[model samples]
Target: MAEEKSNKKTNIGEVVSDKMDKTVVVAVERKTQHSLYKRVIKRTSKFKAHDENNECNEGDIVKIVETRPISKQKSWKVEEIIRKAK
Candidate 1:
């Protein structure tokens, strides 16, 4: 039987930096319970995403999809802008 390929992974986060050309850093924050302490903790992970048109700005909420590596540190691409920054 042939298996269907699933779509690439995607993440939603707020854009933290847009100083690089065609690239932006997105910070995704999540809350998780400590493994043993049973306490809730907040964690943040940053990812570099490619923006073809350089449309992303700092503080914008964006969706990013995993893609083939476009650079040394970029394996994600900007999929859409979920919300505009105030």
Candidate 2:
């Protein structure tokens, strides 16, 4: 069970929204190179993560882990706050 939990997908991203109760929106950005153009491009993905303590705020950096669906849109949970918002 512990090993299976350890294999869950995780993402480090900045919290984009924290308006929902016990939920926060995290935007994870990644850089990918254009196959033909050979240019690096930035891509962002937003995820709704469960924040049991409501400790996250907009602009805060947080680590989120995949978990069982807690809501219709939330399948991720906040693991920890990496950085606080200024």
Candidate 3:
């Protein structure tokens, strides 16, 4: 049989903090239109993701995937480092 792929939730965001041991904070931004005014607005959500190798750095672009909870606030893990910090 062919191998199966898991349908996990994923998000691409920028690393806002890499101060924690084996973890990093990523800020995901999305744009949505206001319900009443129809005005576009930018919204940001921060997620604490596991960086097992501690390779991610602040300001780096990364892709994270949802997984079993690792902590109170960390249910996501770094899937890949999209771009390194300059």
Predicted model with the maximum lDDT: 3
Q: Rank the candidates by lDDT, best first.
A: 3, 1, 2
Instruction: Mark the regions of model 1 whose C-alpha exceeds 4 Å error after superposition.
Output: 1-5
- Per-residue lDDT of candidate 1, residues 33-78 (tens digit): 9999999999999999999999999999999999999999999999
Task: Score candidate 1 by lDDT.
Answer: 0.97
Give a tens-digit lDDT track for model 3, residues 1-86. Answer: 99889799999999999999999999999999999999999999999999999999999999999999999999999999999999
- Report the error of model 2 at residue 67, Å: 0.3
What candidate 2 gets wrong by more than 4 Å, as runs, is 1-5
Q: Please give the distance, in angstroms, between residue 40's alpha carbon in candidate 1 and its true position after superposition.
A: 1.2
What shift in Å separates residue 30 of candidate 3 from its native position after superposition?
0.5
Tens-digit lDDT track for model 2 on 1-86? 45443778999999999999999999999999999999999999999999999999999999999999998999999999999999
Per-model tally of clashing residue pairs = 0, 0, 0
* Higher-scoring candidate on TM-score, 1 or 3: 3
By lDDT, is 2 or 3 better?
3
How do all models score by TM-score? 0.90, 0.91, 0.93
